[model samples]
Structure formats: structure tokens, C-alpha cells
Target: MSETIRLPHKPDAPLSYQFVPGQGPLSTTHLIVYLNGLIAPQSGWRATIDHLRRRWDEGGSRSANHPALLTYDRYGQGGSARDPADDQHGGSHDIREVVADLHVLAQEIRRTKMIKDADASNEDDGAAAADQVPKPKLIFVANSIGCVIGRFYAQTYPGSTAALLFLDSNIANSDQVSLFPDPDAPGFDPHVLLPPDSTVADLRRTRAGYAAHFHPSAPNPEHLDRRNIISLLPLSDGPPLRGAEPDEGTGPRITVVGHDWATFAEEGLRGSMNVPEGLTNRYVNPPWAAYNEGLARLTSADRARGPVIATGCGHFIQKDDPALVAELTDDLLRNIEADSAA
Candidate 1:
């Protein structure tokens, strides 16, 4: 039967998770913990699960060995434990805490029995029977900032994660901020990045102009939880910087991105520009520059790994083309296995 697993986040407190075990007997040698993207839990992962189910049936014996899928929200979202401090930029909200939670979930899965067919005539498998089932290899399927958290975990706990499936994500060390005038730019900022005299009108006009261009993969506004989007806002007031701890190790990582929106927009839209004038390069550059640089550092750490490009998508690849995400996830998990075998 499906269940919930709680892990200690702060002392005397626990983080709650919804654990829906896959139907059928446990047959896979790997377990995939899918991390939800920026907004909230219960968003953007159904397509992924459906894709996996179809593949499991189609691929026959080969797919029968596919990993079990586990998905959970971060501490603040969904049923997870709340963080006392709402400080966006603090270590509490840092990628590390997210990583630690995944670790706890992984350990809990290791201890549990396979969710045997609910209709079976058999009783509990018992400890002896449970011991016979092999330990499931762990893989993390992450998106957006979730990818960043997974990357940190793999680097720190290298042996634990079999692989990472990064969908439309930034994997580099976000060290420095640069200016890019367009507000629609992936990492663009308006207020601090722009000049002092830049009016509120400038900010509103910039956001509106960009909003026209901000076509996420899934256009449904319901998919986003705007109330909890504080995490996506920049942690630091200024352009965010890449902060690397002393011992980041080389770990296996992979990235998948949808078609380049900026290039597409430049080509598709006609010449009349609606964005505010005098928006300096300074304002536009910092976030993307920092995030892109961080992505570079991550990819460089392991050349054999890749930043795989997915076709035809805006920011939310999970919503736009979940089939692509699933296909890529399969390949990524296989690669992780291959690396381990090698």
C-alpha cells in the first residue's frame, strides 16, 4: 500500500512526504526519486509517471527492470515540514537542505519492503523475504533549481546517486551577475540591476513586455503556485553569485533543455518592441550570467556527461513535453548504470 515517510529536518520536527509505491511486485534494481520543480508539489510530474508506465509495458523484459519512481515536495511545499525562518537566501533554503532531505528519503526507501500486489493472497513478506530483494540503486530526477540541489547531493554523496536527469535546468556555479537589457532573459533582473532613476513604470513595463514573451511549456496558470514562488525570487537582493563549498567532487550529471526561446523569439517576433527604453545592459546581464557560469562549472566537472538539448519547449519542459522528459530520463538512468559498471 502507498504511504508517507517523515524525516527529521530540524530537531524535534519531521518533514512529511507522500510515498506512492508503484503497483506490481518489486522487480527493478534502481529507484528514482523525482524532485518537483520550483513552484509546488503535485505539479508537472503526472506526465512523467504516465510516460514511465507506458514504457514499462512496451519495453517488455528490459523495461520490467526499470526503477521504482519516488516524488516529493521540498520542505516548505505540500505536506512537508515548514521552515521556521522564511529567509530566502539562508542555508535553510540553500540547495544543501533539499539534498539532505533526499538522502533521508533514500535511506527510508532502503529500509522498506517492496509494495507487493495489494490483492495478493500472501501475508507480510517478513524480514527474511525482504532481505532477498536487492538494494535498489538510487537515481534523482530533478528540474530547474531542483537539479541544482540534486547536483550538490551527487557531488557530496557520489556513491549514493546512480545518475541525474536534469530537465531544462541550470547546472553551473552561479557566481557573478551580468546585464542583459531584456526582462524576458532567463536570468534578467530589473530593479537593482537597472539605474536608480529607473521608474516603477520601467519595472512594470519591463515585466509586462516580458510576460508577453514568458511562454512557459505549460501555459495553464493553475500549474504555478504563485503564493509559494518566493523561493524562485533571487535570494540576494543583488545579482546572485555562485558560492562553492571547498570540496565539490566530480560527479555524474546530465542536462536536457528545450529549444532556445531567446533565439526563437528573436526570429519569430516582428520589429515593434514593447519593452521599456533605457533598460541598461547592467540590469539584464547578472542573473543569467551567474546561472550560466554555474552551469559551465557543473558540465566541466565531467566532460563525459552532457547538457542534452530537448526540442521545442519553453522553460517548463515537464509541462510541455513530458514524453521527451521520460525518454531522456530512461537514457540518463541507463548511462548511470553504464558508468557504474565501467
Candidate 2:
């Protein structure tokens, strides 16, 4: 069954979420909270949640248990809270708020009572059914900037999460080559990465260029930056990129990797749009250093184990290859189950 509800947050700051409860193994539920990339709320992948819910059912066949999952639109991106008025440059510059909202939302869901079986007179069976209801553990799945939010959440609320599945996501502190910082300067470039500080006419022109080069239909072109650069690409035209596959054997905490860089030409296109030339050199030369440090800190012990390159797909791996996303989701749940058993 599916239902939409608003989370009790700031009166103006409402969150939108879709709930899909899994059948079969009542005791084992997979609670997946996805932090979508930069795509608009009404886009293809947003609609693809229906398919993901169905895939959860398909994956249940192999499971030693059952699962339930939920997906929510983050504030500013979907039907959730609007961007804060103070942050005109970017309402959500501080991602910790997003993490806090997620935590609160999870607590709300856990507190709600599951519907009683129609036949309440089942006696002992009802007791078993009540006991079987899984105490949901959150599995945060995010891409691009969403990964940054997820990273902070894991670090802040270490024990609350069951596992994390970063799909083509930016690892916290990996030495991966990134267009985020300048190679020569080795730091973030405000002008190149963020919109250049210029006149309205010039900003419009830059925004147009971003729309043309980035995603043809960007809601707010001025919002483009190193953080969300990957989320804007359209998925309709890209070649099929192999995605992260499911593994029944592994535990829930996992990092499934994929890239939308396709070939050097595509990389150049992406480079032209957001990354500074210096950062590009750093990205290509060392290939890992520029992006690995934060990723390393976010992951520790058994939780930190992936850089599984998904070739052919660009930054929007979920849209580029939904199959991979579905596979990774399944694998993550399994891995979490395995970890609990250990």
C-alpha cells in the first residue's frame, strides 16, 4: 500500500514522502531513504520509484526475510520544505539540516502503528504478527550532493543507520579526481564552480549556457555548481552504463559506484560546464586523491569498502541506469541483514 504524508517540522517546512510496505517476511523490513540527486521532483527517476517498489518485491524472493521501503523528496528539490529564505545563494548550503529532517522523519514513521490485521480475533497469530513487524533501520541512499548529506548523517548518527549505499556518489574523503577544487590552488573556486559574480545580463547568459550544456531544462540555471553538477544531466539520450549489481552475500552497508563520464569527450563537456581546468588536471592526473579524503572519513571499519567504478554512466547513475540502482538497493538490504547476523 502507498500513502503520502507531511512530516511535522517547521510549519512552513513540510516534507513529502511515499511509503511502500513490503509483504512476505513481516519481521524483516528494508527501510530505504533516498536523497535524490539534482533532478526536478517530477522527472523520470522520480516516477521510477514505482518500479523500485516493485523490484523490492522481486528481490524479496531470495531474501531470508521480508522488507519495507520509503522514499522522500528533500527540501527544495521536491514536495518537501522550501529552500530557506536567508540562503538565496543556496538555501541548503548547510546539509546538516537536511540530515536532521531525515532523522525526525524516521522517528515519526517508527512511532506510527501498523494497521491491525482485519481479523483481530486471530488470537496467538495476532500476537505473532505484531511481534514480527520489523523495527525499521534506515538505509540512506544518495547521489552527488545527496551523498554529502548522507555522509554527514552517518557520521553524526553513527549507530542509527543500518547501512549506506552510495550510488555513483561522491565519496566523503577519497583521493578521487574532482572538478570541485583547482589543482594549482587545490581549493574551491567560487567563480568557476559557482555562478560568476557579474551583472544580471551576464548571469542570464551563463545560465543559458548552463541550460544548453547541462540539462536542457534546468529549473534554475543559476543554481549550478560543483556539488550538484552531476544531477542535471538528462537520462534519455545516454548510452547504457553498467550499474552496481545486487549481491545477496554481502551485508547492507555498501558503496555502488558508477560514472556518467562515458568517454573523454563527455568528460570534456562536463568539465566545460562546471569544473575548473586546474581541478580537471588534478582529477585526471592522480584520479583518486582529490576526492578520497572525505569519503575515507565517512566510511570506517567494514562500512568503508567501495569505489566500484560504473563505466559509461555519468554522474546521474540512478537515472542513467535504474536497474543498477535497484540492484544496489537489494544488495544493501542483504548486506545489512548479514551484518546483523554477524
* Cα lDDT tens digits for candidate 1, 179-275: 2344456675656566664655665555454444332321222222222223333331212112122112344444434334453233323324433
Residue 338, candidate 2: Cα error in Å is 2.5
Question: Global lDDT of each model?
Answer: 0.51, 0.50
Q: What is the lDDT of residue 58 in candidate 1?
A: 89
- Candidate 2 achieves a global lDDT of 0.50
Using TM-score, give the best candidate's number: 2
Model 1 TM:
0.61
Worst lDDT window (10 residues) for model 2?
A: 236-245
How far off is residue 188 in model 2, in Å? 18
Residue-pair clashes per prediction, in order, are 14, 27
lDDT score, residue 260, model 2? 38
